[model samples]
Target: MVAVRRGDVVVANLDPTIGVEIKKTRPVIVVSNDSINQLSQLVVVVPLTKNIAHLSPSHALIPKGVARLTFASKAVTEQIKAVDKRRLVKRLGILPPALLTQVERALKNTLAFP
Candidate 1:
C-alpha cells in the first residue's frame, strides 16, 4: 500500500464526485491517523484549492512553495473526506509541522472540537 501520513500533500484523482463537490484531480492533505493509514485501504483527506478568495476559520492558508506547489493554496477543512488508497496518485510533499498544525486547527474548528 502507498505510505500516507497525516499532513502529507498528495495528488489524487477526486473524479466521480457528485454535484457541488470538489472535482477533478487535485492536491489533498492526508488527515487520517498513521495507524489508520497503515491498516486500512482508505485514508481521510482534505482538498486544497487555488480558488482561495478569502481565508476563514475553516481554511488554512498554505504559502506558495509548500509541497513544491507553484501557487499558494488553501485547505478546505470543510471538504474533508475519505478515499481508497488507489486514488492517491503521488506524494507532492509533506506539510511542515507548523503549517500542518495550522491546518489541524482549522480542521478542529470544522469538526466542532473545543
Candidate 2:
C-alpha cells in the first residue's frame, strides 16, 4: 500500500481494481521529481492533468482527450459517496469488457457505490 502523510497532495490510480489509494505525493509548495518515483511500479505516470505535469518531466504525457475519461473515472470512483455506477461508466467513455468485469467485481467485494 502507498503511504502518504497528512496534507500530501496525491492522485488515484484509474483502475477500479487498484481502488482509491495514494498514487503520488508532492512536496509542500513545490512539486518534486521524487514525488513520482515511487509510482513507477504502480502506474505509467501519464501527464494528463496540470497537477500531473508539475510532478515530473519523465512521466508519459498523454494527450488531453485520451486522458480526460481516465482522470474523470478515477476521480468519480474515489468519491465513492453512493452507488453511482453510471458515473463510472460515463467517465470511462468506452469501457473495455475486461475492465468492466474487473470494476463489477471490485464493487461487489468492496460495495463501493458512489
Candidate 3:
C-alpha cells in the first residue's frame, strides 16, 4: 500500500459508469489533500483524456511525460470525482510544481473559487 498524495497521477478503475461519466480504467490525478487522503477511504481525482481539441476552462492541458502519461492529455476538472482508495491501481508519477499550480488554478476555475 503506497502513499497516494495530492498531485500524484495514478491509474484507477472508473468502470461501471453510466451516461456521460468518464468510463473505463484510466489515469486520474489525485486532487484531494494529503491529510484527507490519509484519513478517508476515498480519494478525490480528476480524469485525464487525450481529447484536447476543444479547450475550455473546465479542462487543464497536461503535457505528455509530465506525470508518466505517454500522451498529452487534458485534465477534465469538471469531471472531478471521488473513488475508494482501493480503486487506485498504481501511481504513475507526480505533477511538477508549475503544472500542479496550473492544475489548482484550473480546478479553482471549474469550482468557481474566489
Candidate 4:
C-alpha cells in the first residue's frame, strides 16, 4: 500500500451516502499527523469544493493548479472526516507546508479545538 502522508491531495471513493453527503469519488487532503497515518488503518482528511461563495477563515481557497490541480478549490474544514486508507485511490500531490498550516488553523477553528 502507498504511504499516505499529511498534506497529500488524494482521490478517494466517497459514495454510498446519507443526507447532505459530499458524495462521489473526490479530491481530499490528508490532514492527519504523519505518525498516526503510518500506524493507523484510517486517515483524517478535509474535503475540497469548487464553490467559492461565502469564503471565510474556515474555508481556505487553494490557488488554481496548486499541486497541479486543474482548478482552484476551497478546503471545506467543516467537512473533515476519517476513512480507511483503502478508500484512497491515488495521491495527487503534496500541498505546500505554509498553506497546510492555514488548513490546520481552520480545522482548529471549525472544530472549536484549542
Candidate 5:
C-alpha cells in the first residue's frame, strides 16, 4: 500500500506487546504530517472505537455508513500512538479536509498546546 495521509482511514493491526491493550485489528486514522509519513517507516494514528458515549472535544464522531464502518465510531484522541506503516492493512477512505482541520484542532487541545 502507498503512504497514508492525514484524515485517511485505514484498517490497522494494533496487537500490543504487553499490558492492558486496545489490541487486535481495528480502524484507525492517519494523523501524522504528510512529509514525515513520506519519509518515515512509522506514522501516528488515532484508533476508532464503536463506543461514542460522552465524547470529549478531542473525540470526533465518525458517523455510521461513513468510510468502511457500518456503525458510528469515535476517534479516541487520547489513545493516539505511532505504529509501523506495515500495521496499516487496507485503506478504507479519506475524511474531508474540513473535518481533518477540526481533528487537528482537537489534537492540539488533547496534546495541550498554547
Candidate 6:
C-alpha cells in the first residue's frame, strides 16, 4: 500500500550521518481531455536539484541543498508561457532583447527551455 496517494506533494530530506536522503515522490495525474486522447495517461513531475557537481569536476560535491524550484511537472511549459507573457507585459512593453538572447542561448545549449 502506498502511504501517499495521487496529488500529494513531497520534499527531500537529506541525512549525511546515515548517508541516506529522502526524496520527493513524483505526482501522477490522469488527464481525460478529448483533444488529447480517450485514454488517461499518467503524467509525473520528478523534482530534481541543481547538480553543483556538474558545475565543476574537481570540487567536492554536496547533495544537501534542495532545488530552488518547488515542483517539476509537465505543466512547466504552460507555466513558462504564462511567465513570459507577464514579462512581456511588465518589462520593455515588448519582448525584451535580453530575454530573447537568453532564450536563444538556452536553445543552443539544451535545445529546449521551459
* lDDT of candidate 2 over 19-111, digit per residue (tens): 543333211110113444344322212112334433221222222343133332221122232111121111212233454344344434444
Identify the superior model by TM-score, candidate 1 or candidate 6.
1
Tell me which residue pairs clash in candidate 3: none
Per-candidate Cα lDDT values, in order, are: 0.92, 0.28, 0.90, 0.87, 0.85, 0.23
For model 4, what is the C-alpha lDDT against the true structure?
0.87
Question: To one decimal, what is the Cα RMSD in angstroms of model 5 from the true structure?
Answer: 1.6
Candidate 2 lDDT trough over 10 residues, lowest sum:
24-33
Candidate 6 residues 1-114, lDDT tens each?
A: 112212222232212222333222222121112332222232222222334334321122212211222322221111111011111111101113443243234333442434
**Residue 108 of model 5: what lDDT?**
84
- Residue-wise C-alpha lDDT for candidate 1, range 40-112, written one tens digit per residue: 9999999999987888999999998999877899999999999999999999999999999999999999999
What's the lDDT for residue 34 in model 1? Answer: 95
Put down candidate 3 lDDT per residue, 83-105, tens digits, no spaces.
99888889999999888888888
Which 10-residue window in model 5 sums to the lowest lDDT?
15-24
Per-residue lDDT over 5-104 for candidate 4, one digit per residue giving the tens place of the 0 to 100 score: 9999998887777899787888889999999899999999998888878888788788888877778989999988988889888888989999898899
The 10-residue segment of model 4 with minimum total lDDT is 62-71
| lDDT, model 4, position 78 | 90
Q: How far out, in Å, is residue 16 in model 3?
A: 1.0
Best by TM-score: 1
By lDDT: ranked, best first: 1, 3, 4, 5, 2, 6
Clash number for each model:
0, 3, 0, 0, 0, 0
Backbone clashes, candidate 6: 0
Model 5, which residues run further than 4 Å from truth? none
Once fitted onto the true fold, the runs of candidate 4 whose alpha carbons sit more than 4 angstroms away are none
What are the models' TM-scores?
A: 0.96, 0.25, 0.95, 0.93, 0.89, 0.18
Position 107, candidate 3: lDDT: 91
